[model samples]
Target: MILTVTLNTALDITYRVPRLRPHASHRVTEVTERPGGKGLNVARVLAALGHEATVTGFVGGGTGRALRDRLAAVDGVSDALVPVSGPTRRTVAVVDESTGDTTQLNEPGPHVSPAEWAAFQEAYAGLLGSASAVALCGSLPPGVPVGAYATLVRAARAASVPVLLDTSGEPLRRGVAARPDLVKPNAGELAELTGSHEPLQAVRDTRRRGAHAVVASLGARGLYALTPDGEWRAPAPDRLAGNPTGAGDSAVAGLLSGLLDGEDWPRRLARAVALSAATVVAPAAGEFDAGTYEKLLARVSVDRVTS
Candidate 1:
C-alpha cells in the first residue's frame, strides 16, 4: 500500500459561476466539496488508478469528521488520519464557466500542539511499516515543525520505503536534504527553491540539493525529469485547456504508482503526463477523466535529454 500525508487537511469546496467579476453579486451555478490537501488529492488519484493508498496526517473537530465521512466513501483509500484538538481547515476554489479558470483561497489550517505532533509521529511510523511507498505533500500547518517532511522522509528511509516529497518554500528545502526518491515541483515552486525560473536548471539544482530525482511540472507542456538513470522531457500531445488545480497531485499519483511497480522513466513520465492532463479537463479537483487518461497515455511523447 502507498501512504500519502497531508499535514494541513481541509474540506475543499469549489464554486462555479457563469463569470467572475470583482465586487459584484453573482449567482452560483454549482458547488462541489471533497476531502482535500495535496496528499489527499494524490490519494484520490491513486485510488482511482486501482492502488491501495492509506491517507495520514492531522484532522480534527466537525470539519475533520465531515472530511473523514467523505473519505470513507472513496474506494481503495483507507483513513488513518491522526486526530488533534483544533478543527480542520477549509479551502475555496471558484471556477469561472466562461474561462474554465480557477481562483483559490486556502485557509492556514488549525494549530497543532507538541503532544499532537508526537502522536502524529507515532502514527506515521506505524503507517510507514506498511506503506510500500510514501508521499509527503502540501504545506506545513501552524505549530508543526518546518522540517516536518524531512523528519518523515528520514523515517520512511529507515523503514526501506521509497518516498516522494512534494512541497515548497523552507519545508521543501529541508525535506530534500533527506534524499527522497523523488520530488515533484511545479514551475513556480521550482523557481522558489532554486532561484531559477528555467525549469531544467531548477530541476538540476534541486537534485544537487539532495533529491535523488526531480520532476518539474511544466503546466500544459508536461513534465521534465532529472534522475540518476537519465534525463527526459515528456510533453503532452497538446496544451490542454481547463482547471489545473489538482493536476500536479495527479502526476504525483502516476509517478508513485509507476515507481512502486518498477516501471521505467519513459513509461512513468507517459503516465504522469497523461494523468495530469486528464485532471485538467475534469470538472472537479483531484479527479481525472478515465477516458481522457486512456486516450492520452499512448499519445504522450517522452524524449531523452542528452548533455
Candidate 2:
C-alpha cells in the first residue's frame, strides 16, 4: 500500500463559466467538489492506477467533513486523516470555458495546534509500517513546523520505506536535504530551489543537495529526471487542451507506482508524462482520463540525456 500525507488538506471546488470578463458577472455553467491537496491528489491517481492507497492528513469542521465524505466514495483509497480543531481550507478554481484558462483562489488552511501536530506525527509513523512507499506533499498549514517534511522524510527513511516529496519553497528546500528517494518539482519550483533556470543544471544541483533522484516537470515539454541510475527527458506526444490543475500530482503518482513495479527510469518517465497529460485533458481537477492515459503511454518518448 502507498501512504500519502497532506498536512493542509482542502475541499477543491471548481466553477465553470462561459467566459471570464473583468468587472463583469457571468453565468455559471457547472460546479464540482472533491477532496484535494497535493498528497490526496496523488493518492487518487495512484488508486486509479490499481494501487492500494491510504491518505492521512489533518481535517476538521464542515468543510473537512465534506472532504472526507467525498474521499470515502473513492474506491481504492482509504482515509486515515487525523482530526483537528481548526476547519480545513477550500480552493476555488474558476474555469473559463471559451478560452480554457483557469483562475485559482486558495485559502490559507486552519492553524494546527502543537497537540494536533504531535497527534499527526504519531499517526503518520503508524501508517508507514504498512506502506510500501510514501509521498509527503503540499504546503504547510499555519503553526506546523517549516521542517515538517524533513522530519517526515527522516522517519520514512528510518522505517525503510521509499519516500517521494512534492512541495515548494522553504519546506521543499529542507525536505530535499532529508534525502528522500525521489523529489518532483515543477519548473518554477526547480529554479527557486537551485537558483538556476536551466533544467539539467538545476536537477544536478538538486541531487547534490541530497535527493536521491529529482524529476523536474517542464510543463508541456514533460519531465526531466536526474537519478543515480541515469538522466532522461520524457516529452509529451502532444499538448492536450484542458485544465492543467493536478497534472504535477498525477506525475508524482506515476513515478511512485513505477517505482513499486520496479520499472526502469525510462519507463517510469514515460508513465509520469502520460499520466500528467491525461490529467490535463480530464474534466475535473485531480483526475486523469483513462483512455487518454493509455493512448499517450506508448507515445511518450524518453530520450537519455548524455552528460
Candidate 3:
C-alpha cells in the first residue's frame, strides 16, 4: 500500500463558464466538488491505477466533513485523516470553456493546533509500517511547523520505506535536505528552490541539496528526470487543452507506481508524462481520461540526456 500525507486538505470546487473577462460576471454552466490537496489528488490517481492508497491529513468542520464524504465513495482509497478544530479550506477553479483557460483562487487552510499536529505525527508513523512507499505533499497549514515534511521524511526513512515529496517553498527546501527517495517539483518551484531557471542545472542542484533523485515538471514540454541510473527527458506527444489542475499530482502517482513496479527510469518518466497529459484533457480536477492515458503511454518519448 502507498501512504500519502496532505497536511492542508481542501474541498476543490470547479466552475465552468462560457468565457472569463476581467472585472466581469459570467454564467456558470457546471460545478463539481471533490476532496483535494496534493496528496489527496495523488491518492485518487493511484487508486484509479488499481493501487491501494491510504490518505492521512488534517480535516475538520463542515467543509472537511463534506470532503470526507466524497472521499469515502472513491474505491481503493482509505481515509486516515486526523481532525482539527479549525475548518478546512476550499479552492475555486473557474474554467473558461471558450478559451480553455483556468483561473484559480485558493484559501489558506485551517489553523492546526499543536495537539492536532502531534496526533497526526503519531498516526503517520504507524501508517509507515504498512506502506511500501509514502508521499509527503502540499502546503503547510497555520501553526504546523515549517519543517513538518522534513520530520516526516526522516520517519519514513527510518522505517525503511521509500518516500516521495512534492511541495514548494521552505517546506520543500527543508524536506529535500531530509534525503527523500524522490522529489517532484514543477518549473517555478524548481527555480525558487535552486535559484536557477534551467531545468537540468536546477535538478542537479536539488540533488546536491539531498534528494536522492529529482523529477522536474516542465509544463507542456513534459518531464526532466535525474535519477541514480541516468538522466532523461520525456516529452509529451502533443499538447491537449483542458484543465491542468491535477497534472502534477497524476505525474507523481505515475512515478510512485512505476517505482513499486520496478520500472526503469525511461519507462517511469514516460508513464509520468503520459499521466500528466491525460489529466490535462480530463473533464474534472484530480482525474485523468483513461483512454487518453492509454494512447499517450505508447506515444511518449524518453530521450537520455548526455553531458
Candidate 4:
C-alpha cells in the first residue's frame, strides 16, 4: 500500500471557456470537479495504475464532505482525512479552448487547529506501519507548522519506509533535512529552493541540502534524476501538447510504482516520463489514457549523465 499525505486538500473545479479575455464575461461551456491537491492527484494516478493508496490530511465543512464523497466513490483509494472546523478550500482552473491556456484562481485552505494537527500525526503514524512507501505532497495549510513534512518524513524513516516528498518553499527546505529517500521538485520549485535556474546545478544543490536523491521535473523535456546509483536523463519521445496540470503527480505515481516493483532506475524514469506524457494528453488531471502510456513507455529514452 502507498500512503500519500496532502496537508491542504481541495475541491478542484475546471471551467472550459471559448476564449479568455481581460475584463470580459463569457459563458462557461463546461465544468468539472474532483478531489484534489498534489497528494490526492498522486493517489488518483496510483490507483489508476492498480496500486492501493491511502490519502491522509485535513478536510472539513461542506466542501470537505463533498470531496470525501467523491473519494468514497473512487476505487482503490482509502480516505483517512482528519476533520477541521474551517471549510475546505476550492481551486478554479479556467481553461481556454482557443489556445489551451489556463487561468487559475486558488483559495487558501481551511485553518487547522492544533488538535486537528495532533490527530493527523497520530493517524499518519498508524498508516505508515502498513505502507510499502509514502509520499508527502503539496503546500502547508494555515495553523500547520512549516516543519510538518520534516516530521512526517522522520516518522516514515523510523518505520523503515521509503518516503518521497514533493513540495516547495520553506516546507520543502525543512523536509529535506529529514533526508527523505527521494524528492521531486519541478524546475521552478528547484530554482526557488536552491537559487539556481539550471536544472543540473539545482538538483545537485538540492541533494547537498539533504535529500538522498533528487528528481527534477523539466516540464515537457522530461525528468532529470540524481540518485545514489548514478544520474540519468529521461526524455519524452515527442513534446506532448495538452493539459499538463497533473503531469508531475503522475510522475510521482510512476516512481512509487517502480519502487514497489523493484525496478531499476532507468525503468523507473521511463515509467515516470511516459506517465507524465500520458497525463499531458489525458482529458483531465490525475488521469491518463492506457494506450498512450503503453506506447510512450517503450519510446521514452533514458541516457546516463556522465561528468
Candidate 5:
C-alpha cells in the first residue's frame, strides 16, 4: 500500500476566463474545486489508477472538514489526518484560454501547534508502518520544521520502505540529505534545489545531493529523469494547448504508480511524461481525463541519454 503525507492540505479553486487582461474585470466561465495538496493529489491519482493509498496530515476547521469529505468521496483512497488548531489553506488558479496561461494565488496555511505536531507524528508513524512505499509531498506549513520530510525519509528507510519526496525550497534541500529513493521536482523547483539553470545538469546535480533517483518535470519539454542506472527523457505527445497547472502532480502520480507496478525506469519515465501532458491537455487544475491519458500514454516517447 502507498502512504501519502500532506501537512498542508487545501481546497483548490480553479477559474477559467476567456482572456486575462491586467486591471480588467473578467467573468469566469468555469469554476472547479478539489481537495488539494500534493500528497492528496497523489492519493487521488493513485485511486484513479486503482492503487490503495492512505493520506495523513494536519487538517482542521470547516475547510479541513470539506477536504476530508471530498477526499473520502473519491473511491479507493483514505485519509488519517490529525486535526489541528487552525483552518486548512485555500489556493486559487485563474486560467486564460487565449494565452493558455494560468495565474495563481496561494495562501500560507495556518500555524500548527506543538500538540498538533506531536499528534501528526504519531499518526504518520502508524501510517508509515503499513506502507509499502511512502510519498512525502508539498510545502512546509508554518510551524513545521524544514527537516520534516527528511525525518520521514529516514523512518521509511529504517522500515525498509522506499520513500518518494516532492516538495520545494529548504524542505527539499534538507530532505535530500536523508536520501529518499526518488525526488520529483518541477523545472523551477529543480533550479532552486540544484542551482543550475541548465535543467539536465540540474537533474544530475539532484542525484549528487543523495536522492537515489531524480525525476525532473520539464513542462513542455516533458519529463527528464536521472537514476543510478542512467539518465532518460520522455517527451509529451505533440503540444498541448491548455492550462497545465497540475501536470507535475500527475507526473508524480505516474512515477509512483509505475514504481508500485515494478516497472523499469524507462517505462516509468514515459508514464510520468504522458500523464503530465494529459493533465495539461485536460483543462483545470489537478484533473486529468482518463481517455486522454490512455491515448497520450501510447504516444509518449522515452529515450536514453548516455553522455
Candidate 6:
C-alpha cells in the first residue's frame, strides 16, 4: 500500500467558462467538487489505475466529513484522515475554454494546533509501518512546523519505505536535507529552489541537494527524471489541450504506481510522462482521461541525456 500525507486538505471546486474576462462575470457551464489537496488527488488517480492507496492527514469540520465521504466513493481508495477542529479548506479553479488555460485561486488553509499535529504524528507512524512506499504531498497548514515533511521523510527512511516528496518552498528545502528517495517539483518550484529555470540544470542541482533522484515536471514539455540510472526526458504529446491543473499530481501518481509494481526505472519515467499528458487532455482539473493515458503510455519517448 502507498501512504500519502496531506497536511492541508480541501474540497476543490472547478469551474469552466468559455473565457475569463477580468472584472466581468461569465456563466460557468460546469462545476465539479471533489475531495482534494495534493495527496487526495494522487490517491484518486492511483485508485483509478487499480492501485491500493491510503490517504491520511488533517481533515477538519464539516468539509472534512464531506471530503472523506466523497473519497470513499472512489473505488480502491482508503482514508485515515485525522480529524481536526477547524473546517477543511476550499480551492477554486477557473478554466477558460477558448484557450484551455486555467487560473487558480487557492485558500491558505486551516490552522492546526500542536495537539492536532501530535495526533497526526501518531497516525503517520502506524501508517508507515504497513505502507510499501510513502508520498508526502502539498503544503503545510498553520501550526505545523515548516520542516514537517522533512520529519516525515526521516520516518519513512527508518521504516525502509521509499519516500516521494512533492512540495515547495521551505518545506522542500528542509525535506531535501533528509535525502528522500525521490522529489518531483514543477518548473516554477524548481526555479524557486535552485534559481535556475533551465530544467536539466535545475534538476541536477536539486539532485545535489540530497534527492536521490529529481524528476522535474516541465509542464507541456513533459517529464524529466534524473536518477542513478541516468537522465531521461519525455515530452508530452502535441495537438491536444485542456486544463493543466493537477497534472503534476497525476504524474506523481503514475511514477509512484510504476515504482510499486517494481517496474524498471525507465518504465517509471514513461508512466509519469503518459499520465501527465493524459491529465492535460482531461477537461476537469486533477482528473486524467483514462483513454488518453493508455494511448500516451504507448507513444511516450524516453531518451537518455548524456550530461
- Best TM-score goes to which candidate? 4
**Any runs in candidate 1 off by more than 4 Å, and if so which?**
24-29
lDDT of 3 by residue, 174-235 (tens): 99999999999999999999999988899999999999999999888889989898899998
Q: Can you list the residue pairs that collide in candidate 6?
A: none
Native-vs-model 4 lDDT?
A: 0.92
lDDT of 4 by residue, 259-286 (tens): 9989999999999999988998988766
lDDT of residue 134 for candidate 1: 95
Q: How would you encode candidate 1's per-residue C-alpha lDDT over 143-168 as one tens digit per residue?
A: 99999999999999999999999999
Please write out the lDDT profile of model 2 over residues 187-221, one tens digit for every residue.
Answer: 89999999999988888999999999999999878
Model with the higher lDDT, candidate 4 or 5: 4
Prediction RMSDs, each to the true structure: 1.4, 1.3, 1.5, 1.2, 2.0, 1.8
Q: How close is candidate 1 to the true structure, as a TM-score?
A: 0.96
Better of 5 and 6 by TM-score: 6
Task: Write model 6 residue lDDT over 1-307, tens digit each, in one string.
Answer: 8888999999998899999999998999999889999999898898888889999999987878888889889888888999989889888889898986778898877789999999999999999999998999999988899999999999999989999999999999999989999999999999999999887888989999999999888877878889987888887778766767788898899889999999987789889888887887886678899998898888888888785
TM-score of each: 0.96, 0.96, 0.96, 0.97, 0.93, 0.94
Off by over 4 Å in 2: 22-29
Sorted by TM-score (best first), the order is 4, 2, 1, 3, 6, 5
Q: Against the unseen true structure, what C-alpha lDDT does each candidate score?
A: 0.92, 0.93, 0.93, 0.92, 0.86, 0.89
Q: Per-residue lDDT tens digits of candidate 5, residues 195-300?
A: 8889988888888899999988877787888898888888767758766767778888899999989999988887788778777777556778888888877777
RMSD of 4: 1.2
lDDT head-to-head 2 vs 4, winner: 2
TM-score for candidate 2, residues paired by index: 0.96
